[model samples]
Target: MKKKFILLSGLATSLLLSGCWDINEAQRMYYVDGLGIDYKDGQYEIYLQLINFTNVAKSEYPNPQTVPAEVGQAKGKTLEEALFKLFRSIDQKVFWGHMTFIIFSEEALKDKNALSIIDTVLRYRETRYQIWTYCTQDSIKDILLLTPILNKSLISSKLSTPLDTDDQETFVEPVNFRNLVIGLNEPNHEIGIPYVTINKNWETAEQQGQDTTFIGVGVLSKSGFKGLIKNDAARGMQWMHNRTHRGEITFKLDGDETDFLTVTLEKIKVDIEPLVKNNQVTFEVVVKLNATLNGLKTNVSEDEIRKKIIKEVKKEIRTTYKEALAKDIDIYRLSEHLYRKNVKVWKRLEKDGKIPLTPSSISKLEIDVNQVNSGRKTFTGTFND
Candidate 1:
């Protein structure tokens, strides 16, 4: 009787384990790694970066014709409408579970209702909040279509590189939807996403057999792109966020001579102090950095190089900070300073303006950079040439 009871219990357990509740197979649908959204004229345009599985599988085998990816686009009155239209045109079911990027076109950001569109993406149950987000000075569609000729795998496989994230070396940092939402909800902070611009030579892109090409950055204020920020301005944005990891800077050594050096930042800290007196809003931004000299093409004394780096870094920081102030972007958390230091004034300021940023309020900018080490002299690995 005991053996019979045991058999019945085993049968019951097996019956409960039968099927998938929300199972999805990779083969059944096409994986989307990047998405671009743009608003032009009167419609919303959606671009999807689709991965080719067969070519990706054949990447190990040498074949030049195996292009890594393809692009698809569609337009509609609403975001979902445009997306569904794009899905219907594609041969396979579009799956965004593996998606890593989202790029917004300048036009899309122009909408006063831009935040509403953002709300749609975040509110979706299937959308992953951790995916990297960017803005493009050019059309979002063009940026999504960029695939290098040598890219044998596909767009989906290529975006995994760490370069996309903001480090000391890069001016742009990969800001995701989650970070944006968090900043928006915070009492005294603003958000900025990295920007991209399309490479001009499309025929060359096709002839060269590459998938996509882009450059520069898209700047955002409140609802949309305020304008495009390039070169030093972008660098300033990185400094404001205190996100520099590994960056290169050129310093003037002597007359008509300049030396290039790369530094890997070890630590960064920023403090914002705001004061209101004599009916004037005064802001003091202080930034501190500890860095290692990682690269140097021209040899120089350690002491000399250290001095040059500090001087150049100070100039760069001041210049960039000024640019941020000009744009009133507040890449640094100046609003947070006001809230923490003087809550009553911040409340009054908020009640006065829809866009709560002011350029004239800045009174001082101070930057300090300390050189830690000049990296190791000997490489651990053997180089066979």
Candidate 2:
């Protein structure tokens, strides 16, 4: 009985001891916060922002100041090769589960191997599918090296928190790795990635002074980079996609272009209907918005102002549609809507190589603006004093 008991104890001890053999210390692992990819001359450059958890965990109250992250880079012919090279050179093993976002340069998306790079990254077990993706026209190195000045944190809160904002201040809708892949696999295979840029004064000498700005939407067709829609057109793209939540519109109060009144959008609803007749495709877009009078730079009737706002909204939608048509890109995904609603008509059009929407295809657009709040009542001539 004593010998049997001794043998059981020895087996239990071995099992516990074996579990500790592969254990890794938390301090020995590098946690990545963000990743940036750039491609040039058939070479892939990978940039990683490593978070400093020690500083983040420090017990500092109210206005704690500490360096939050550091940047590292490695280059090779493919993403896996570049990542392996990066891991081999670093002293600590890199952990990507904490990675918050990924940015691809315009040049990187233009490469033929861009899809392969995305596949390689997604295949890794360490990377999360929820990481937000972006495309930038600026240098990927500059964007990766940017330090948050106002936020004064290790990671740039502006880049990380944009998707969570309740306001429509952000023009383009953010796409995650999983949705991007799903969109690419769809029948139309149309997707748009938000565009980012750095705004800085070259004359300024401060290191953490520059600000990152989201400028436009980068359109991708059939899993390839197509083009960009910038400025108000970007906002228009959001309107067409039914992604606008809360935004502001500035328009001339009357006939004077210099006099402007800004209205804050409280709510918006968009309806798109696709119709086919005589072998021709046309889309009708109707936009309805509820707004409040936020600014009044000139004295004008509220009724006239509401009319002007509606006209401006319609114009923006038309301009955005024309721009997309000119590039032969469908930012609105009307083709997908047609396929889902009327597959037979879509198939007939597809057989004729007309699955995508064109400029002349969008025949009608309508916009209605309702002023839900006019602010404090205004009296003319001080009550006849």
Best by TM-score: 2
Q: Candidate 1's error at 267, in angstroms? A: 3.0
Whole-model lDDT per candidate? 0.64, 0.74
Query: Residue 363 of model 2: what lDDT?
Result: 78
Question: Model 2, 1-385: lDDT tens per residue?
Answer: 9999999999999888756668778888988878899987779888988877775454232144555667778999888788888888789878888787899988888887778777887888988788888898898778777755553454445566566564756466778888788777774676788898997753345453786778787776554788888887766775665567777777876577687778787567888888888887788888888877775554567678678778877777778878777877777777777878888888887732238566677778887775546776451212332
lDDT of 1 by residue, 268-326 (tens): 67677887886556787776777666564555566676667667766766665566667
Off by over 4 Å in 1: 1-24, 54-67, 148-168, 187-189, 198-216, 257-266, 276-279, 291-307, 351-360, 372-385
Candidate 2 residue spans exceeding 4 A from truth:
1-18, 58-66, 166-168, 201-208, 351-356, 376-385
Query: Which 10 residues in a row give candidate 1 its minimum summed lDDT?
Result: 376-385
Q: What's the lDDT of the predicted structure labeled candidate 1? A: 0.64
Alpha-carbon TM-score of each model against the true structure: 0.76, 0.88
**lDDT value for candidate 2?**
0.74
Q: Candidate 1: lDDT of 121?
A: 79
